[model samples]
Target: MKSTLKKLLPFAVVGVISGATTVGVQQYFGHTSNNEDGSYFTTSKNVSFAGMNTSAVGDDFVAAAKTTVPAVVTIKNYQTKTSSRASEQDMFDFFFGDPTGRNQRQRQQQAPDNMPSGLGSGVIISPDGYIISNNHVVAGASKLEVVLSNKKSYIATLVGTDPNTDISLLKIEEKGLPYLNFANSDNLEVGQWVLAVGNPLGLNSTVTAGIISAKGRGIGILGGQGKAANPIESFIQTDAAINPGNSGGALVNVNGDLIGINSAISSTNGYYQGYGFAVPANLARKIVEDIKKFGIVQRGFLGVSSLDLSDDRQVAAYNAEKKTNLKVGSGIYVTSVTDDSGAQNAGIRTGDIITKIDNIAITDFADLSMSVGSKRPGDKVVVTYLRNGKENTSTVTLKDQKGGTSTRSKADLSVTEKIGSDFDPLSERIKTDYGLNSGVVAKNVTEGSEIAKIGIVDGYIVLEINGKPVNSQKDIERILDKYQGNVQVKFVDDYGRIYTKGFKMP
Candidate 1:
């Protein structure tokens, strides 16, 4: 019986092996076994042992790159030469040489007629051809060109620029281009992952990844000769390896949403040295929208300068000034409120400790500036402060640089005159040569007129009246006569530019 069982086992094993081999071959050849009723069984022959293991990471980065790279663009700027100055070498040769030879050299040394060229990067902010970049990129540029990811280049026009923030807006003629949507920078965490996308070192559409190193960082990086002076320096610092060409690029989050504009880097060698900074997207969006609507940023001012309470002496002074339960180092101490400022108009006095703006608690000047900067000129905010050892709150209506209320009504210049004796008309040669019809040439200004109050200086030319062309003083008078009430006068200078200003007719 044992010998018979062993022989049967061998036969069974052979039958099982042969059946397995036949099944494998059938599956490979796309043949599935079916029941006698002709119902087929489904099977797959190429099942991966490590199934879906590489899809999450390998596919995610490729997908993000494909989505974001297309929105990044390269910006090229050109400046036209107005007048040429002699080169230093030529001037030295002429000044130190013999009189006859110097005159001949001066005659031979003529300035080049070509303009200087510059390059930078810009990010498309909207689908309708709006772009945001650094002001330094397109400053004094005569021509601006933007190159899209598809290698298509288009001429761009300068929409507006804010030197205080180092931000500039540009518009391309083509519409419906790929763009990035802004994410709320206020929601960003300190260690959140981010990507810096730009034309770094002229390598177009380059991307580098890092985490947000810090927030609300005040590094005096943008302060230098010939740079736009910025009073506020709160910046979002990252370790994304930004370089020269990364200015005006997009600093996006992991979800491919833009959270900031890559603006500057901290380096001595003029290259990436790990520390890069970006202007928060919230600020960028506000400035861009304001520029689009108002042609300039309507900055809100608190009208008071304050000292941070973090300083021991300042904290002691504030504590001594007001006997309260407040800690030694708590909030920003108001040092002085300028007369006629918004704060003064709102009855904010000196020695008041600002504890909160709106609902966010303020710890220092940066917090106050960031909060105020986030608001428009007319927006009113509740300021919580400590006065005389007692907590108080007040609703302060913000004001623009010009001392005005929280409305868009035409500024009152009723007490002013149209053209003072100080008004100097443009010369006939300048008017005829520049193809002028009517305009106002500014001369000496008074101390308290509307023009002087708004900082319009001598030599400024009024170029248009009520949106109509005004090339000379005669045109301004005619338009003022035609529209006797409030009129919008556009001003231009010796250079061909325009500024829209409002004034009431006398």
Candidate 2:
């Protein structure tokens, strides 16, 4: 009995030591949420809010402003101007020579040198120089420049842009720079004190304070008229005095943690009237990581078109037309489900009311949109809905826009595959008439392809592919061969307007 007791004592001691080690490690590392949408981080470190007590005793913002101001940068966009006057025959003859009388072809108009088009702000979110800015700030830019608060400047490389979310990722060749850390926006409450830091009206390093006015707002400012398709707007509204140059600025909490990216303002004069909107940090963080990893956002679609229950007029009309007693502000009414979509696969049918996504209640469309927008394809979500006044839950496996359940890399598609069009060598007549050295004509452009999506039609002349001259199909293939990222194509549309559009490989 004494020998058995001695042996058990050693085992008990070992078990105690092991348990102590686990508790210590957990205390240091903290409890991280394993969300279905994955995590957001700048480095390998887990996201933490250890000291982020929003209910703390002070309203002082000096420390918060000081911590965040140095990280915001002013972004300048330089774009090449295509003169419309060069397109008309009279103006063309005035600029060059007349084409009818002379057998010689008119000289092609030279594009004007790139000029500074606009200015915005950006937030450095990493010590290694990763920046988050609005996509509209960098869209159509031939060159981008970033100026730090210290008056130092660097030529910025656009890693990727998602116009859907109006978020862009940029990089500068620098190290050990000051940057802001992301905070979970889901933890933010209404009336919380926050700060907006940016350069406004050419004013550098300006900071303003305000409270969170609202959340889950969709203002319809993003999509339409040849802009971003399928725009996602779930903004954190604040009265933070955001201005023209504050478009891509930082919206931080009183603790100096980044909670949102300053994006749009609700104003009639284009200046701050009272309220401004910001893209939430959780969504922005997801976009930044996606752009850094895949060169494109891995957006997951729920595959159902629904009406927002918050709109009383629309809901009333829907209820009356459908002869149902659906109440306003209840949930989203599913009108149609896309074929072969995750919702359809999950057995969600028309007339069903979507009540919840995971644990979040869907009172508005923006709530559901933001919940799904932050997730990537192949991520599973537990969806709760109501069918005929009965609640049901389904585990849905989300899919990409292409209906694939797998993750995609930019290298997955070749240039031709991305363009989805065939190329043929330009005719001798076209070459001589346009005074072109080399060119190829787009042919058999497939519908729903990137080329067609960008409004490129059949017979559009391609002068350059990624800044390299392309005279034949082989030329395009060679230039874009193994190119695993964004490709810029210089095209001469039917109106002779030169357009330099960008597209991703996948």
Candidate 3:
């Protein structure tokens, strides 16, 4: 009886050990499933799952891209052909070289029946369909189409364009569209992560990421008529791989906030070669707001031309001329002031080296420009400058591009004091030499006249009425008398150069 009991105990112990080993293996492999009471276990060979630990970098970037890409859009523009003269074709041929020198034959042949087409990128700025893009993208375009990531295309209307800043605003008819909010570009620090979203090379909704390479970099690319000199070129440089078609796209922070508009690139091959430039969203916002309010950007200018402090010789000469003991290592040296610019009005002289604006240190011309541009016309700002080794502060009211105190009045002679037109007519020799048939010569300018107030001097010859040739004083008087309100006059100086000035007649 004892041997039988021992044999049963050994068998029972072996069965219990084998069952425990099976349960351990099933638990480690996650193949065992249990009920709430822990009394039942089940396993299915066909059901399988696996997972791995991932990093937050991938998830955060992916989420940012998803949020930003939808607000980035592809802008397609079409400029209508107004003439079939083949002037553009001839110009193209002159540089590109005609395969067959039959330039005459090509010119005689009918020009392409279609309009010129171009593509770029834009950022949706408002949910009600206001989009912002570079002016060059939609300038002179007869038709503009904006396409979103959701495959919805909307025709956009050009609200306004500021060529000085290369910013243009457009409005789409659709409402409640996805848009991106702007970040304070002034707060962006070097080395912050940024993402560039655009239609690079027509590749729609492409995003490239990199850190901010620099801030306040001036590339000297933008310039044209009535366009102020490239004053505000404090671009935020990045390595975000902005390509040709990426112009007007958004350069966003990692949190999906728009900080800048991707503008130009330092490239030799016309493609991304690492260096890229963007207009700060702060400046862009000001320009966009100005263009939206007025048909053009109403920018405030100090009206003083300045040279970089890097030009030591010029700095020294300026110091000597102005009799100032300013150390020539920093700050902008004012070279000349326009006759009636804000600086001139504020008694800011040519020799004054602007050292600070609103307590912010002015390191160079770019700094001054950015500071001034940040404010609208009529906004008063404090300018601290060094003159004759003495620091002086002035509270100067900003003026618009047309040399006016504010942008409220659009009258041609709003800011100018109109001088009475009591002047001797231009002589025949002076007319022949100046290449004008006839016109009235500005002999005496009164102090209260708009011309005198804005710095137009006596002795300037009126050359054209509207744009037509004015051969006599009768012609000038006739044009002015006929146009009772505001009129634009094209006049030639004694040296024969022509300039256009607008004035309101009494």
Candidate 4:
């Protein structure tokens, strides 16, 4: 019995040694796996490090906060107010009648009997004082005041703005500014850490951290309240705490590179409720370049209306409607193709399922919109679609809204399109009544058009635009083509009275 016990004791000692070696090896590998570059990291709690490595290595967001917060600035939009009262809430501020004391203070500060002004945020993108922000932040502002992180204020001039993407570019008369560098948002994976740096609730340089909950999110929030008529919404969704004043702020990756611009939040109370949406940096960068160079967005259109196949119920409905679908449903199901669109030119039919673009999978409508929206007209893209479960690829050359593949110069853009007015040639009867041989009639005035603000109504005859005759549509287009700054429009009202109003080009 003594000999047997001795042999068993030796075996037990060997077992203990083996267990100790195994534990040491696990600890070493676990600690080595800790990422230092901050590209991506897994939760330490979920990883069993033999209970030895317990520190939170990937949870600290200080490095990202420090890198991004300095590039974000506060924007004050100063615009004309029809009503001279302090009752209205500031734009990008708290909701109207917000009970918070902070909100009340902001209302008192911004709503003081003066021009209707609001405060928001912007991110400096260039060292020469080129800042990019949401168009709503500076839209309709006669003057824009930008306050940097150092509290230095500059009266910025509008470079250009695109309402479709809700992106605006402002330039200050300064150079060598600290700016946020752009990162490719197309490579951003779900669950990657992202830090939002902005001025939420008027608090400047507020930094919040969260994971990329989703990509290619379309919430239909932009162009709301009749701001942008045709809104392009392809948002990067995150769990970041983005509130008012966070718009145009930088959403940086773990490496402190700009991935997105915080644009809106999904909440019933007009505040952040765990869901914040941002404009992808890729698209925003393109819009900014277009606005700065061409004074207009050169958007590429795929020209196909389609539905996403994310939900099982929607897939089932689509299948029921088609009456021919067998099973596997993913990507977008093309419903219709626009006439003379890039899709039509590429021979993309209604029954084709768009699966990929340039090697990137199209999971939803937002993905397709962004894929085409990211490029300018005249740019080409490779589209891969599945027809009857057979894969096919087409290299599609995208076209502009005018169905042209050439870049539109500033002079080619029409004033009627910009001012939102439908001008028609003056009829013989109206011409005779107005005592004018050649004039154009404002057939229909858009509700939110700048021409509408001039008090010009439908049936009013435009006698002269910018001191030029309005005898034909070509005349009007030629006069206002790429025309910037103030344009004096003289017209005879329906009451046979002459009215002249000076409207600054937006």
Best by TM-score: 4
Where does model 3 exceed 4 Å of error? 1-54, 82-116, 224-231, 311-328, 339-341, 409-506
Candidate 3 local lDDT, 280-328, one digit each (tens): 9999988877766665566777777887785577678867897865565
Cα RMSD, model 1: 24.6
Q: Give the TM-score of candidate 3.
A: 0.66
lDDT of 4 at 27: 43
TM-score of each: 0.62, 0.70, 0.66, 0.71
Worst 10 residues of 3 by lDDT: 10-19
Count clashing residue pairs in model 1.
6
- Index of the highest-lDDT prediction: 2
Candidate 4 residue-wise lDDT at 151: 97
Candidate that beats the other on TM-score, 1 or 3, i.e. the better one? 3
Candidate 3 — which pairs collide?
416-450, 417-449, 417-450, 418-449, 418-450, 419-449, 438-471, 438-472
Candidate 2 yields a Cα-based lDDT of 0.74
> What is the descending lDDT order?
2, 4, 3, 1
For 228-320, candidate 2 gives per-residue lDDT tens digits of: 566788999998777667878999998899999998776533346678899999999999998888876788998999998888988789878
Tell me the tens digit of each residue's lDDT in model 4 across 471-494: 887897788776779999998764
TM-score of 1: 0.62
Report clash pairs, candidate 1. Answer: 438-470, 438-471, 438-472, 439-471, 439-472, 439-473
Worst 10 residues of 4 by lDDT: 10-19
Expressed as tens digits, the lDDT of each residue in 173-208 for candidate 1 is 877888899999999999887888887645677887
Candidate ranking (TM-score, best to worst): 4, 2, 3, 1
